[model samples]
Target: MKPADIDEFFRRLAADNPAPKTELEYINPYTLLVAVVLSAQATDIGVNKATGPLFQIVQTPGQMVELGEEKLRQYIRTIGLFNTKAKNVIRLSEILVAEHGGEVPRKRKELEALPGVGRKTANVVLNVAFGQITIAVDTHIFRVSNRTGLARGKTPEEVERKLVRYVPARWKPHAHHWLILHGRYICKARKPDCPACAVRDLCAYPDKTSERDMLEDPPVPVPAG
Candidate 1:
């Protein structure tokens, strides 16, 4: 896409949602980190369902450690890879307590050093929790970025680098959330809702869904790719 179209693309998204936020529920940075970890292969709604009660009981690393891995597993049992996620959560909490004084680190390197926290997770924590202008290229953001021709890349890391380098500074803070919401609701995987998409005209996707397809059947839900 041209520079002018790229600017307009984000402008429409930002205009639609002046303030987009993560669907995951959290009380503070500690809980935000945990929520992002739990959301690895799960839906935000699912993670929120589990974390809603978990956060009410444990908001800090100390509380999470005291809750223990076994107990944590019980809370997140519905989520995929609960056993592994539980262990990482406990281990990360312990590190936070021991090294960062129970606070989530602001730096990407330190955040990634924690168990189960990868680049995407660190970017999310940095952007949402710390107000840093970092884009976390999850499945949703990945699809929207490529489909809209805003920043096409074969890998998440490549797309993320492109977004950071190209996206306007004014739109950087909420870019992730806007793209995420767009993909989740409109530019879906199975069949994008092109008719309802705000940026359909600006999108570079060649195989746009037709009005007949939208009327015939709703798009099937697919796992994020």
Candidate 2:
């Protein structure tokens, strides 16, 4: 896509959702950190299903530590890789309590230092929890990027770099959310609902749904004499 088109693409996205937010439900930075970690390879609905009850009980690193790995598994067992995620959450929580004084770290290096918190998770935490202009290239965003030719790349890191460079400064903050939501609801992996997509005309995908048949209205009946 051209630079101007990129700007307009984001303009439309931002206009539609002025204040985009992560789908993962959390009360604070700590919970948001843990939720993003758990959300890896899992759907937001799946993560929320587990975290809804888990957060009510474990709001802090201390609570997570006290919950123990065995108990932690019970809370997040529904998500994929529950065993690994449970262990990492426990480990990271302990680090937060001991190293960061129980507060989620705002810096990417500090966040990535935590177990199970990778570049993607760190980006999400920085963007959503700390209000930074970072984009976490998840599967949804990755697909959208390549499919729309918005930021074509073979890897997440490459896609992230392109997105940061191509996206307008004003829209960088919410770019991740917009792309993710668009891919999830409209430009899906299977049959995309291009006809309903807000940016379908602006999209570069050649296989997008045809807009030709969608007429505005039939000819109005002649007025009675």
Candidate 3:
């Protein structure tokens, strides 16, 4: 997409969701960090399902340490890779209590230093937990950026770099949420709902679904994010 179209693309997305937020539910920054770590290979829906009750009980790092790894496994057993995820959650919580005075670290390097927390997870925490402009290119953001010709790249880091460089300053704060939500509901991986896409005309994707398919198959009701 051209610079003008890129700006307009984000303009439409911003209009659709003036206050976009992460689908992951959490009580505080610590819980948000844990939720993002758990959501790595799993869907937000799945992570939220597991974290719903867990967050109520373990809202802080010290509480999580009290819960312990073996018990944490029971809470998140339904999520994929629960065993490893449980261990990481417990260990990271322990580290937070020991190193950060029981608070989630704001620095990217400090966030990434925790177990199960990578650059993407750190970016999510920074963007969602705090008011940061960083965009974490998950599968959704990666596909949407490339598909719409907004910021094409072979890797997530490359796409994030391009988006950071190209996205206008005004839209930077919520760009991550807009792109991720658009990819999830409209520009889907298997069959994008181009007929209902607000930025369809601005999109450069060649394989956009036909209007006829909209009538024949019909679009499912998109759940509220």
User: Pick by TM-score: which candidate is best?
Assistant: 3
Q: TM-scores of all models?
A: 0.95, 0.92, 0.96
Better of 2 and 3 by lDDT: 3
CA lDDT scores, all candidates in order? 0.91, 0.88, 0.90
lDDT of candidate 1 over 79-152, digit per residue (tens): 99999999999999999999999999999999999999999999999999999989999999898888879899
The segments of candidate 3 whose C-alpha lies over 4 angstroms from its true place after superposition are: 215-217, 220-225
Using lDDT, rank the candidates from best to worst: 1, 3, 2
Q: Which stretches of candidate 1 lie over 4 Å from their true place?
A: 217-225
What TM value does model 3 have? Answer: 0.96
RMSD of each: 3.2, 7.3, 1.3
> Sort by TM-score, best first: what order?
3, 1, 2
Candidate 2: C-alpha RMSD after superposition: 7.3
lDDT of each residue in 1-225, candidate 2, tens digit only? 999999988888777777767888999999999999999989999999999999999999999999999999998999999999999999999999999999998898999999999999999999988889899999999999999899999999999999999898988988999898888876778766677677888788988764453244222221111
Which pairs in model 2 have colliding backbones?
A: none
Model 3, span 58-175: residue lDDT tens: 9999999999999899989989999999999999999999999999988999999999999899999999888887999999999999998999999999999999999999999999
Task: Output the lDDT of residue 31, model 3.
Answer: 94
- Residue 167, model 3: Cα distance from true site in angstroms: 0.3
